[model samples]
Target: MNEVKLIDMLSYLEPELLEDDYIEKDMNKLKNLISKISESSSLITFNKGLRSIIKIITFIIASLLVLVGIIVIIIKKKKPKITKKAFNFVTN
Candidate 1:
């Protein structure tokens, strides 16, 4: 084929080679997509961190509540079975 026809055929197959506008648009679209992906990943990291912190706080609160309940139960009860043994031991 002639050089002119070969060039035309190649250009028709690859339109971006013939137009600056298409190249610019393609670059802009790629940049925007990259930025969106970066932002979404950052958001995911933040959400995971927040969820981890919340889980740790919830576990701590549950443990403290259980400890408090056990203490209260032990302190609030009165038993009468130990007085005689205590008096005999003290007298001996």
Candidate 2:
């Protein structure tokens, strides 16, 4: 019922029920599959990082463009002031 008793029972029966060659082959297969999964997970993580970087860069560029546009509009809407001269010449 307990973990230790279960393990002891399995250990006592393992040699009679299981073959060493089959166990070794299965362990090797499991190791190879685990290695492949690890490699794929790393690649997926890298891709996620690249995507976030791209999004941040895009957001920064868009904000800058919006700021520049607002500045341009403000500059274009301003009109130059005109002043009259104190002394005016008579027309010929």
Q: In lDDT terms, which candidate is top?
A: 1
Question: On a 0 to 1 TM-score scale, where does candidate 2 land against the true structure?
Answer: 0.60
Candidate 2 global lDDT: 0.81
What residue runs in model 1 are displaced by over 4 Å at the alpha carbon?
A: 1-19, 78-92
Choose the strongest candidate by TM-score: 1
Question: Per-prediction TM-score, please?
Answer: 0.62, 0.60
Regions of candidate 2 where Cα sits further than 4 Å from its true position: 1-20, 79-92
Residue pairs with colliding backbones in model 2 are none
The all-Cα superposition gives candidate 1 an RMSD in Å to the true structure of: 6.0
Worst 10 residues of 1 by lDDT: 75-84
- Give lDDT tens digits, candidate 1, residues 53-91: 999999999999999999877755533335666888899
